[model samples]
Target: MTAFEATFEHEARPISRPLRIALLGYRSDPFVGGQGIYLKFLSKALVELGHQVDVLSGPPYPDLDPRVGLIRIPSLDLFACDSHVKALRWRHLRSYSDTFEWCSMLTGGFSEPYTFSRRVAKYLRSSAKPYDLVHDNQSLGYGLLTLQRRGIPVVTTIHHPIHRDRQLALDAAPNWKFRLLVRRWHSFLRMQEKVVSQLTNVVTVSEQSRQDISGAFGICQSRIDLIHNGIDTQTFTPNSEVAVDPWQLITTASADQPLKGLRFLLQALAQLRPDFPQLKLLVVGKLQPSGTTARLIDKLELASAVRFVSGISTEALVEHYNRSAIAISPSLYEGFGLPAGEAMACGCAVISSDGGALPEVVGDAGMLVPAGDSGQLANGIATLLRDPELRKELGLRGRARVVERFSWQRAAIQFSNYYYRVIANADG
Candidate 1:
């Protein structure tokens, strides 16, 4: 039986009735990334429970539930344009924020998080409605401080701190120049670290993330709350008809960064290819062609065996998971490891590393190996590939695990409960 069945079996007791919620995020795409999916389903789930939801987001805004109003706060994302570096028009230069965004990207600094926070801060200040609570999705900025000062009940969810990204990049840097560039690119982490430490009533995606944030940012663990992220078990269920071609494997790599450990997965594949020439990988994200992941792909010469597809619908991604013989999560670290959870939910025999929260997500249902260990990853994949019965058993167990523990409805209700508690504490 699924976890949902157990959660449903127990009668849910509500401490408070519905209230107005304002969810703040920089971006919200249901499938483009996890944050968007978080906002989309969360808003919908909140609405389903008779709460009024308004998601205020910036560029690459979310496709949200129609019942939940989406407030767009635009930012200057030059890279998102069809044109390259030449795409910047003179008009774009007129805005200070736009100029900052363009110039920062040119110089290798990541300015989106800062700029988006500025935009959102301005928006919240101008809004007419008074929300019972303001829930921020990892955009830890002075803007949240502004909301709190305004006497709005503020709670921010840090999926994971960006400091982890910085540290990972530093570890993977091949030279001093690249290390400097990596540090520059992660300059936003300084702001995030500062903001997170000062923010009261913070929430996180997992217990592992809570510990990581406390260790990385020097924040008090008691100030942070754990709210496990959810997966749509109904949507990601298994399809036996999904044909697995060759020694096929699927994974989701949203970015071509070292942190995702795609390079590690490639190395594992390299070791396996000698014994299994039929091995192929299908990634549910695009390859930048010239980026680090792309370069790694070229170095491995597995370009023909590996495929990347992005911007697909949720159903399409589930189909990709269902069709694969196995799903692998090669991330060096994850706050919640959504790909692991989603793949397990889809009934794909999962081979994940003990990277950050992956073990928490995969649990005892799927195979676990050491993070950054290519040999173990290769062996786990080989084991699943060779054993059909084992794969089926693992996959079935995984789907059941997800159905019991991770669901958007449960997460939303939990958030609702937390919001009331935060408010009660404040009132007290």
Candidate 2:
């Protein structure tokens, strides 16, 4: 018999008992993107709420809380090495899964999720300890169906939809060839769409994301749950010692991706520079060498005025937030705008685009501009630059807003309840 059908005492516990949760991620590195950040904090929060949380991730493993277990699910990790060809080993050929990954990356295809799922399925079959449920961190891999068949109740959080990013990148591609390459890179959306529809319990960060996921994956709205992501106010709070730089604007974005709207921010900065020569930008992300963003920065003639900082610690990020006069979220879409919320938590004035769930998070605490509008973004920056009193007031209001509505503690409680709901249904 399965664990779910074991002796009554072993199979079912008191409703108050702390759950055993396995959080799955195909690839998670906290500094890489928002998904990694989600895994890091949610695992930490779940553990703090007295649940046993194990994060299963493939290489570039996440920096997780010490108490939360990290089960390193190894992959080819081709992206980490100097060259994909050089990264290949004889052991890789021994496994068809690894061979597929090597071959996929060789041809500009992403095969991590597919191979990672096979690894996860194998591990679950042999794992001595069983879990009450598996909470997926947007992997949406076929392993989830395997888990369900093996009696592991599964729920997943679809953080917006990859299809949205794929479309935005395709639209921004300079030529049909580049668009075809983009299409090939994002072909996993087909699997995600199929998997999302089959899963019974789906959670998303915002109502905006829920609608987008439903539309993008053609899934029913009733299957998705809304869980507002939280900001760590204690760690991201205002540092009075770090004086705000008057002319420096800050934003966190994925440098080359069209969905981030970083290109538009660069355009807005170029527009503002002549009027405000001292104006500088602190970009909290990598500026890939020889990439579109790098070329655009040179074209805009703002090389000296813009600086990129990546892979900084949370403390360092909080310091950056405190040091800026205004923080901006220029994402074309975000399931939940963590950077804007972090800025607000740091007592910094914010100007965010009404993209995805940003307006929902900013909520009268910050200025809102239309997404992809460089002129409006520039004007919003200028307004904050001219008005110190307004900035101070907004900063105060933003901090208060974070304190009132957002916290990991609250999110953990909600998630624990959600977990029990899924578990209870499975048991019944």
Candidate 3:
């Protein structure tokens, strides 16, 4: 661990007050995204620390610990169902927020963050007792401002700005039409940028993210606190008995998205296949069977070698990590690379692209390749696959790094201290 990380871990305060926390998110699904995983583990950790957490979420609500209460604010994008576009009930039209959410998405604008925050503010206004603090998960919007105006102490966790996604997507797009759509999809960043600057206290997943966000969103650096995200080390630990296959490599890919760089990884895999016929890519996401990924696999004639697995238990995921000798994180950008950290925590050697906060997360524990470089990725994976001793050594060191530096207990304590500071500052 770096000296700074070690110091932060050592200085964390373990509080016993059992504070009431209102954790807010626009969307969370335990297995799918980092926000959901953060909510799931953080809420569970807060509960472990003797606090009560109630999650207020929108469409595709998080599957949190049973102890955490869920107040689902229904969205027109129910279950992310594409079919919901045509099946809106008349009663749904009565809800102006729901109608706006549906119309915004249909018109190519992502409106969940704005609509959800409005609903959350409305809910809080009607509740009998206000929460001790309101913790927002990146949905910086006007309603959050309302909460602050009403004297509810609020702290937001900005897991990096959405502008990075827009920039990367614009750079990747072939033409102006796609760029326009990309801008439309991320239209809510304007709301976030305004809201973020006004929010009193903000938490970020890493120092790198905090710095990047401050620069990207033009927010003051002092307003953002760095709370390194955790690895569920016990659940994601090494599986020794699962024999590591020499030619099998694994990665988590959001198949439908371009920013995931799954296409680049697939292209690299295509290059490597002729030289290493036994090689296979095990992707841990639902394959968009009809998307560009499937077409690319067919074009590369790797349809038989690539496998996609989804909805597996944490144990099953760890098992998959163990089955592979090495793991790859090929994201074009990441707020904090959880897949890299999780693979590292599981004792699997990792090769991660130096995208966004990934290098910050890996911190010499694993190999670093330039983002979007298919040749470099192929070389890194090939080297690790050929060198078992190097893989094992890196794997051991990576696991040690996460255990010592990134733990939910540590995050919870740090967050609790920040909670106190925010509350004290508000009162003062």
Candidate 4:
């Protein structure tokens, strides 16, 4: 049976009142990654639909909507501090969870998801007022089943398997030490994988991700709900006043990760350098000064042609999208390619690699290149640049696609309906 086809003792009834929702996240710093962006927009969208939403998050909290209550689920937050070792206090050593968090970081492990889930389970166990449903933002910790066992209806969104990242990182690792460290850091996957098999109500953003979750975690497809995330077109809309730079290109990527396919984009840039010397590339991500991406940039001698920006406001991001001649998404894989959609929403001509659900988002609105193919990427960008009329056509069509297919209002309605299904299944 599909997610909605499940029957419950509650007879799988539709909800009549506003839902009491608790959205959980281990970490949600927008500048850090896309999870923050997901948390921020999803909560806002739910509240706009008349749902009562409270975001429960760990340190490096997300920038949330005013109507969404923020419940701080504090952690050691070692990642934020200048030094993970120095961040630990004497009192922190007394608490096993805090000490585990600190020591795990010190040993190159990520303990936040497992640790945060423990805290949430403990807190909700004592909560006098119960929520209708708990929505987990890819945290997949054992505590989800803990909540379910305690009569709490839990719904979890697994964007993609971190195992993909771990394997890719190992392939990109410079040596055995780094590869071992990457494996150690992602040890929390053991818990996540186990949690996926045990949970009955699960949601995923794309069919690609749903299949991936099924394969990677040994779970059945029937339990996974497919709900596409919405684009905030209001903020990501086209600004006619922002003039495009004919020779400029833009992409949002995790610069240090091999999964983002940034290396291939850089290679494409290098291939086009001789003919398009005036071409400039703008990346909306932090380039770690001492990381692999920075080294590649120096090796490619692209410092002059490329620029990196981070911590910018949404307005600025949309401005960059508006000004770019073409926006490219070269991800090796994605649960859902949000940057491509956001760029499309801003009326930016997009050229996305056939990575994961990118084709689902781009459709016929923009160009599609083979993932990790620098030659194809270069050809696509050069083709768009040589034809301004074609570029303009693609940009207009792209925005129209976003308007027709994706919106937060629509997503909220879908999620609210799924929440009821999960609640009903739990009630059964």
Candidate 5:
């Protein structure tokens, strides 16, 4: 049985009454990454379930549903600014959080999670209103302890142990200097580890993530709740009108990120060029000019065969998926594999790496190759390319699986049940 199916067997009883919930996100913009997408969809789904949801988020705010309220918790947002050193002001000195954020960014450390949590904790303490629960999206900072001490119920979702990303980046760094910078940037993991270990309730997106979180944070596997993320079938459905391009393959990844495994995909693309010269890749991410992926593209001479686009709307992204013959996810590791699930929802034949929780998401619906293996990825792509009927069959199956097993409504129901249990235990 699938993880979702197993979870359903021991499902907690759902709360009869609507909950007043607060979802916390440090940086919640859909374009920023999956955390934002998680907040956006999860809030929308919870609202549909008749819950009054308020998203308390830091800068780069999420695009949320009209039913859900947004409580802005402003931060330095130094990364958005062109020059972090110049962005600080005398006014910043008034607030320790702001000062710390500014100084941390200047020194190549990410302090958003810690600072955002501080701001959020202060907001909650001062506000007259009380929430039934506060659900935090991976911002596992020390401030959560303050909430716990105040008799507030809090559940944290750690998408995956970010130590995986840190390790992958350190491995990919060209020199000791670069590796040192990577370590500095991910220094927040120390705080996260401490926070997670002390928190009463913690959750993750997949079983793979649960295992990884347990190992990375030294937490017990049984303590972590597993909730599979959902795909928006209504928005990402198959477009029958759009003609699929036979030569087009699409993938969504941060082009320069070592964990995204764009390099392996590019190498696979290079290997298939001689057999299928017309094959081209469409990347749904920004291209960093000086990044390793850019250099690899030049080295492999696949620039002409590859294209990158970013800052696209959901409608545009769905259209791109429809236009493509196949979607590929070559990530070295993924917590939940949103790209692969989105592709499946769009009825696109998918080829994904067996990275982290990708197999849990893709299952038998799509082709799976070992992560970071160019030869296997190329072979999988070539097989799909040569067999149109197989691609069509996989596309239909993928769509069916998503519609059946993955939906925001189902996820919200599961969340509500989990919330009910957390609150009951706290009260008891």
Candidate 6:
């Protein structure tokens, strides 16, 4: 067993009653990203475990289980507006959080995490309701420190550090001007760095993330707890009724994001087209008209071979996975690789890059390729395409792995034990 598992086994204890838990997220719309998904599922799981769970969030609030309460914390939500400058009003100037958010957007800095924390801290301090614990979904802002200082038990979940994202963005910048803009937009990392160093009781989604969080934030490895994220196996299960498309491949990615490594996948798709003229890619994400991925698609002359879809429902996503012969997760790095796990749960033959924590999720059930290598991605895709028996075998094994290892019910139980430990330590 791993050192973390050993430690958890020794210290874990059962709580006598359900917990009044508060989950915090700066912005939580599942369509926005993984954080929203994390909040949505985790909250639902906790409620299933008979805990009173409430999600405190900013604009683009999460679509949560009806049993879980949502306390909305308003922000400027400048990104939703066509023009940040025009979005600001005289009333926004009245609140410091609003003013800071507006000004930060004007200067190309992201202040949502910092501002969200401030709003949450104020709300918690003024409200009479008592929470056994405040779980932060990676805001990592100074306001978390404020709650800790106020004698509140705070457990922050650092789902891989934003430091990794910043460095990757810097590496992908086309020019000095773009590099400068990238640095400016990620300025919140400074606050995150400071806050993480001071906070006690921190946790992460995977072992890779536990190590990365330590390296990126200068924390000790033993200080962070690990709880692997789960897939809703019931929702993502394979549909034997849906016929698989042998020539089609599917992937989920934010097409324009450098960290997602969609460019490499596109390159691989281009390489395979000559050999497999019928091969096509279905990307489950929006295609930005002027983004890097769009330009790459044009240059590769693979526009007709690719299709992009966004804002899809869970049932639709599962159906897509069921219909595809293979699912590929080409991310350069992932905290827990939810898409990969979900695909595995759906019984797709997965071709995943050996990126951060992806190997941990894919395990021996699927094919692995070196991250960011288009040549190897193409080879892996070709191998899966040509071998129908292998695809069927891998699909069954992938589904079994997800069912046996990753489930929200199991995750919720582990988290319940972890929560009691934190509350006990705080009480002592």
Q: Name the candidate that leads on lDDT.
A: 5
Residue 239, candidate 5: alpha-carbon lDDT? 97
Model 6: per-residue Cα lDDT over 1-428, one tens digit each: 34546645543444458999999999999988888988999999899889999999998999999999999999988889999999989998889999999999999999999999999999999999899999999999899999999989999898898877888899999999999999999999989999999998888999899889989989888888888888998789989999999998999999988889999999999999999999999999999999899999999999999999999998899999999999999999999999999989999999999989999999999999999999999999999899999999999999999998888877788889888878888999
**Model 1: what TM-score?**
0.92
**TM-score of every candidate relative to the true structure:** 0.92, 0.95, 0.95, 0.96, 0.97, 0.97
Q: For residue 291, give model 5's deviation from the true position in Å.
A: 1.0
Writing each residue's lDDT as its tens digit, candidate 1 over 356-419 gives 8999999999999999999999999988888999998999999999998888888888778788
Query: How many residue pairs collide in each prediction?
Result: 5, 0, 0, 1, 0, 0
Candidate 3 Cα errors over 4 Å, as ranges: 1-9
The local distance difference test score of each candidate is 0.83, 0.88, 0.86, 0.89, 0.93, 0.92
Indicate the worst ten consecutive residues by lDDT in candidate 5: 1-10
lDDT of 3 by residue, 1-428 (tens): 33223446457667848789999988888776889899989999998998889999986878888999998977776446767578578898888888888788778898889999999999999998668999999888889999999989998888887878788778877799989999999989988888888887777897778878989889777767788899999889998889988888899988867778898889889889888899999999988778778888899898888999998888899999988888999998888999899999999999999888899888889999999999999998888877889999999999999998889988998888778777888888
Candidate 3: worst-modelled 10 consecutive residues by lDDT: 1-10
Q: For model 4, give the RMSD to the true fold.
A: 2.9
Model 3 — TM-score against the truth? 0.95
Clashes of 3: 0
Between candidates 3 and 6, the lDDT winner? 6
Superposed model 6: Cα runs more than 4 Å off: 1-4, 7-15
Distance from true location, Cα of 196 in model 4, Å: 0.7
- Which runs in model 5 stand beyond 4 Å of their true positions? 1-7, 10-15
Off by over 4 Å in 2: 1-15
Tell me the spans in candidate 4 whose CA falls farther than 4 Å from its real position.
1-15
